[model samples]
Target: MIVITAPTGNIGRHLLPLLLESAPAHDEEVRVVVRDPARLPGAVRARVEVITGSHGDAGVVDRAFEGADAVFWLVPPDASLNPKDAYCGFTRPAAKALAAHGVGHVVGVSALGRGTPLADRAGLVTASLAMDDLIADTGVAYRALANPSFFENLLEDADSIREKGVFTDAADADRRAPLVAVADIAAVAAGLLLERSWTGRDSVPVLGPQDLSPNDLARIMTEQLGHPVRYERQAPDELYTTLVGYGLNEAFARGVVDMKRAKDEGLDTGVARTADTASRITFEQWCAQTLKPAVLS
Candidate 1:
């Protein structure tokens, strides 16, 4: 059996269909740990065994990982907690469960900048890397998909772009860095789970086809969406204050601010985009396919 966590989420929602489509041929049964079974489509729930609860819960992972060959792990963001508690604390229980269950191979969704100087200070990214360490310590054959900021993140700015022809971020206007589509991340995760041929622990960098800066993104959005788009660089302090004002934990707000600062300082530029590392989705393509619709709608 193969287990998947957060099956109704962005990455999991895409990963499930790919696994479900191929698992039958491989003689693999798919199981999912989810809080709300109803969030899964009727057809999806029928195809997999559902363990209902937060995967962060020891009891839920204990049940889900039992008799499972490989597992896809994803931690849903909880802004109520600090960075370490949000990522590492959430995975601690599951890490123990993996060892106890003796699951062979595991694929986890994680961030980039593991070996870079900025990694230790990148706040949330630092916490994510630490979580990867915790999982690897369990001695399961683990592959942490180290990914950069996703194109899907732009969806959060769609309304602002549509209304004012502008979007905001903490990065400098001309500082280029890799970005990826969540679909590509999901596809990579599915492939690893199905193959299960690799051993030991290592991170796979899912850098997209090319690097892009805020200005590049604005230019692409203008051409694809048929509107004049502009980039707005927000101060890190302002971003932090806004997040905290929205009732997020103070430490969590600082984590976001620190992450933004690191990315601006080239935290994500450590990885070179080669064929093996670069994923298929380009930002321009994603803008046309995903962003345009979201903005126009």
Candidate 2:
């Protein structure tokens, strides 16, 4: 049996079916841990057992892990003041549950630049690495899916583009950072679960396609939308205030600023080599396929 947490989330929606298809057909079962089964798309609900409960709920997590051979785990980012404590509190219980249940393998959705000086500037990626380490300590075989920034974040700037013809951030418009499609990340995660060969504690970094700066992104969007779009660097304090005004709490806002700082400092840089890792999707294709639709919508 395989258990999936956060099944209705961005990656999970794409990953669940792949997991089910990959499972051995005889008596294997695919289960999803969800807060409300109704929230799941009707198609997904039809295919898997929906165990309703919070990820942090001991009884709920334990129930989902029962007889499960492997699990896919991820935690949604929180902007609360006590963000770290909240993360540890939520993940620790689940780790304990996985330990108690003797689950064999784990595939975790984490972020890049963890376990380095860049970690502090990488926002929640740092906390996620810590969470992965905690889970690894439980003696379960683990794979941490360390994905770079998601191209989907561009969607948040749609309103800004429509009104201001551009979006503002804290990075130099010329600096480039690799961006990945959430679908590609899901594909990689699903592949790992199905293969289940690389065991023990390991981090799998998924670099989507290429490095792109905000200016490059704006240029791509302009060509796609048939309208002018541009990038501008906001003052750090102004960027902080804007994020807070956008309803992100202080801690998350700080984390966002720190991530921009990391990009500006070149902490997110890396060369793409397809040999040592999995194949990745490109930014231009992502723009044509995913970004264009979201912009038009």
RMSD to the true structure for each prediction, in A, is 0.8, 2.1
lDDT of 2 at 249: 80
The alpha-carbon deviation from the true structure for residue 163 of candidate 2, after best TM-score superposition, in angstroms, is 3.4
- TM-scores of all predicted structures: 0.99, 0.92
Q: Write model 1 residue lDDT over 143-216, tens digit each, in one string.
A: 99999999988898989999999899999999999999999999999999999889999999999999999999
User: Candidate 2: where are CA atoms >4 Å away?
Assistant: 24-27, 270-272, 276-278
**Tens digits of lDDT, candidate 2, 1-297:** 788888888888878877767665544678999988998878878878889998878899989898888899988666764456546667888899899999999998876776567776565555666788888999999998877678777777877877778877788888887777888888888877776777779888777666778899888878877889899889888988988998888887877777677767766564354654444677677777876677677
Separate clash counts for every candidate? 0, 0
Q: lDDT scores for all predictions?
A: 0.94, 0.79
lDDT of 1 at 43: 97
